[model samples]
Target: MEVKSNLLIQMDILGLIQANILTPVVLFFLLGLVAARIKSDLKMPDAISEFLPIYLLAAIGLHGGLEMRNTGFDSMLIPMLTAIGLSLVFTLNHYQILRRLGKFNIFDSYALASTYGAVGAVTFSVGLSFLKNQDVASEGYLTAVLAVLEPVSFILAIFLTNLAVSKQIKSKKKSLSSDLGNNEKILGMVDQSKTNLSGVLRESITGKAIIVLLGSIIIGYAIGDKGFESISIVFDGLFTGAIAIFLLEMGIIAGQRLDDIKKVGVFLVIFSILIPTFNGIIGVFVATALGLSLGGAVMFGLLMASASFIAAPAVLRHAIPQAKPSLYITSALGVTFPYNIIILLPIMFSVSSIVHNVDGSINLFNYFGIDL
Candidate 1:
C-alpha cells in the first residue's frame, strides 16, 4: 500500500485554478471575508443566500436521480446504502478522535460529531465540477448518496448525545426529581434539557434536503431515460450557473464570519484541514475497494471525507446547545470545506486514477456504496 507521489496531481489542481471555475468560489469567499472585515456594503442578500442552498440541493438531487435512473436500480441501490451508512459511522468516529483536541465533553461531542460527519453540499458540488471539467466520468446517482449522508449523520450524533444526557439524568434522579417538584415555574418552562432523540431522528429523516432529493429521485426514475427533458432544459442547463452564484454567496457568508474564525485558533484550524484531509485519504481507499472509476472514486472520496457546516450545525443548535457553535461552524465553513473544494479534490482525483491502474478497466458496475 505504497502511495505514489506523482506530478499529475499537482497539474490537475493547477489546471482547475487556471480554468477559472474554482478561483471565483475561492476569491468570492475571500471577498466576503474582506467585505465583512471592512464592513463593506457589498453583501449576499439573506433571502438569496438562504435559497441558494435549496437550489443546490434540488439541482444535485435531480441530477443524481436522473443519472441513477439511467444506471437502473442494480447500479444505484447498493452504493447509495453504502454511502449513507459509512457517512454515519465515520462521522462519529471522527468526533471521538476530535474530542481530545478541544474542551468538548459528551454534549459537545455530539454537536461536533454531526458537524464533522455531514458533507457540505457546496464542497460536493465543487468535486462534481472538477470531475466534469477534467472530462472524467462519474455516477450521477452518487448525488443521492450525498443527499442521504448529510441528514443521517446529524441524526446519529443526536442519538449518541441524547443517550449520554439520559445517563446523566438518571445519575441525578432523586435530587433532580426533588428540584423539579420544588420549582413549579421551572417545571412548566420548556424542557430544553429533554432529548427526544427519536423525534429528532424522524424530523431529520424527513428534512427538506431529503424530501427534495427523494421526490426528484422518484420523478427522475418515473421519467426513466428521458430525464425530465422538458424541465431539465431549464433546471439542468442553468445548474452550473446557479452553483456559481451560490458559491459567490457562500463566499460572502464565509467572509462575514472571518472575524469569528480568528477565535478558532491554530490547533482547531489544523484539525479542520487535517480531518477532512484524512477523511479524503480514507475515502480513496474505500472508493478503490469499491472498484469505482477514477472520477467516481474521487467524488465519492470527497463526499465521505467532507464535513458538514450547514445541516449539522442547524441540528446541533437544537440538540446540543452547550457546544460552542463557533468552533464547529467556523472550523467546517471557514476551514476544511474551502480547503477540500479548492485543493483536495484534484489531488484525490489523481489518487483515484493511480489506484484504478492497479487493475485498469472500466468497472462502472461498482462504486462508492458499500453494498455495491
Candidate 2:
C-alpha cells in the first residue's frame, strides 16, 4: 500500500505536468523563448506591451469585485488577514536569510526579500488558467489576496530600508559628534530617511498597477452581476488570450536576460529556485490549514511562490537605489518566474490535491478535527 501510494503521487504529478505544459498559454511562452533564442526579430509593439498588463489587471479586479460582492466581506476576511500575515513574515524571513546566510549587503537583502516576498500577478493568472484546465474551481475573491500581498511586502521592505538607514545614521552620528559639519550632514541624512517612509507609502499605494487593480475591483463590486454581464465579453472573454500574449512577451524578456543568471552567481540562482519551492509548500500547508479548498490552496501557494518582477522593480529600483537590479530582476524573471510557471505550479497543485483529498471532499482542517 505504501508503494502504491508513492506511485499514485508520481502519476498525479506526471499527469499535472503533461496537462500544464500542453496548454496554449505555456506553448506561447515557449514560442517566445524560441523566438528570442533564435534571435528571430520577433518583438511585441511598445503600445501592446504596455496595454496588456492594464487589461489583465482590470479584468481580474473587476471579476474579483463581482465575486466579492457575492461572497461578502465576512467570508474573505480570514483569507485577507492570512495574506497580510504571510507577506510580513515572508519578507522579514527572506531578508534575514539573504543577510545572514547569503552575506548580502543590507540594501540588496531588503530588495531581494521584498521582490520574492511579493506576489506575481501574471503567475497567479497562470495558476487560474491551470485550475480551469483541470476543471478545478477557486474563489474569484482570491484576487483580493493577490492585491493585498504585493503592496504589503513592498511597504514592509521600505520600512526595513529606512530602519536600517536610521540605525547607520545614528552610528555615524555617535562616532562623529566632534565634527559639526559631519553632524549636520548626518542629521540631514536622518531627516531624509525619516521622510522617505511617507513617500514610499504613497508611491506604493498609488503605483499604476495598484490603482488599476483597486479601481477595477471597486468598479466591479459597484456594478455587481448585472453590470459584469454587460462588460463580461471584454473583461472575461479576452482575459486568457491577453495572458497568453503577455506571457509571450514575458518569455522574450526573460529569454533576453538568460545570461544575467550567470552574472548573479550560482548561489542566487539556486536561492531563487529553492526558496520559492519552499515557500510554495509552506503556502499550500497554510492555505489548507486555513480551510481553503484544493484550488484555492493551489492559488495561494502560487501567490507565495511567485516573486515580483513588475511591481517590485518599479518600487525597489527607486526605493532601494543601491541594490543591483540584475540580482533581483534576473533572478525573478529569468529563473523564479519560469520555474514557477513550468514546475512549481504543478508541485503546488499536487500538494494541494493531497491536502484537500483527491475527491475534494475533505481538507486538512477536517482531517485534523478543526472546525472552520
Candidate 3:
C-alpha cells in the first residue's frame, strides 16, 4: 500500500514537470533562451515568428480534417463537443477564481476566462511529439477538436464578459449608496469589440491560425491517400525541422518573458501553476473511469490542463480591457504553458498506466457520458 501511495505521489510530481520539461519544442525553446542570454547573434525574423504559427496551425488542421474525412462524421462529433464543453467549464472556473482573488475585476475576469479557455498551440505540438515518441496512437480528429475548442471557449469568455457588464449596469441603479457608486466606478471598464462573441468567433474562424488549419485539412482531404503519399516530403519530412525553428523562437520569447515574471504576484503565479496540475489529476481519474487508452488519457489530461495565451488574450483586449494582462499572460505564458509543455505530459502517461492497471475492463468509447 505504501509503495503504491508513494508511486502515486511521484507520478503527480513527474506529471507537473513532464508538462514543462521533456518535449523537443521546449528543448529548442531552452536553446533559444540560452542563446539570447549568452548574446548570440541568433534571431528569428519577426515576420517568420509571426508566420510560423500560421504554418503550424494550418498543418495540424489539415491533418486533422483529412483524418476526420477517413473517420467519417459520426465518430468525430462527440469528442469535439466534449472538448468545447471542457474548454467552457475550465475558462469559467478560472475566471471565478481570479475574481475571488480580488486583484482582478469583472472585465478582467472575462479576459482571464477567455485566456484560460483556449488551448496553447505550442503545448499541443509538444504533446503530439510525445505521442509520437512513445509510439502511441490517438484519434487523428483531435486536431480538429483542438481547433474547434479554441473558438468556442473564446466565445464563452466573451459571453461571460457581456454578462458581467449587464450585472454592473443593473447594480449601479439599484443601490443609492456612495460606496456602491464607488465600486461601480472602480468596476467600470472600457469595452473593446474583440470581447464580443460575434467578433471573437469571426476572428477565430478567419484568423490566421484557424484559417491555416482548416485550409490544410481541406487540401489534405481533397487529395486523400494520394496526397499523403505525395506531400509526405514536406508534411512528414520537414515537420521536425520546422518545429525546431519554431521552438528556437519560442525559447527566445519565453526567456524574454522570464526576465519580468517577478512582476506577477505570488498568489496569481501559484494559482496559474497549480490549477493545471489539479486539472490533470482530475483528468487522470476521469480517463481511468472511462477506460481510455493511456495515450488518449494523457492527451485528454493535457486538453483539460492546458491554458491559452493566443485566443483568449486577443479577445480580452477588447471585451475586458480593464483586466491586467500580466495576470493571464504571465501566468499562461510564463508559468502554465512552460510547465505543461515541458514536464506534465510524461507524468500523466505514467500515472495513467497505473490507473488502468487496477481497472482492466474500462472502455470509455462504449460508455457515453463518462466526462472524459
Return the top candidate by TM-score: 2
User: TM-scores of the models, in the given order?
Assistant: 0.84, 0.91, 0.81
Error of 3 at 216 (Å): 2.1
Q: Rate the local accuracy (lDDT) of all candidates.
A: 0.71, 0.84, 0.68
lDDT of 3 at 339: 72
Candidate 1, residues 1-372, lDDT tens digits: the string is 213323344345467445543454556656666676687778667898788777777767777777776665566677677777777787777777667766467766677767877877878776776665565668777777776676788777777776776666556564567676655454333245766777777777788867876777677767755748788865677766676777766666677777777897787788788877787877777766766656778888888778888777667888777788988888888788778877787667766765665333435523433342
Clashes of 1: 5
Task: Rank candidates by TM-score, best first.
Answer: 2, 1, 3
lDDT of 1 at 368: 34
User: Which regions of candidate 2 fall more than 4 Å away from where they truly are?
Assistant: 1-11, 186-195, 359-372
lDDT of candidate 2 at residue 175, scale 0 to 100? 85
TM-score quality measure for candidate 1: 0.84
Whichever of 1 and 2 has more lDDT, that candidate is 2
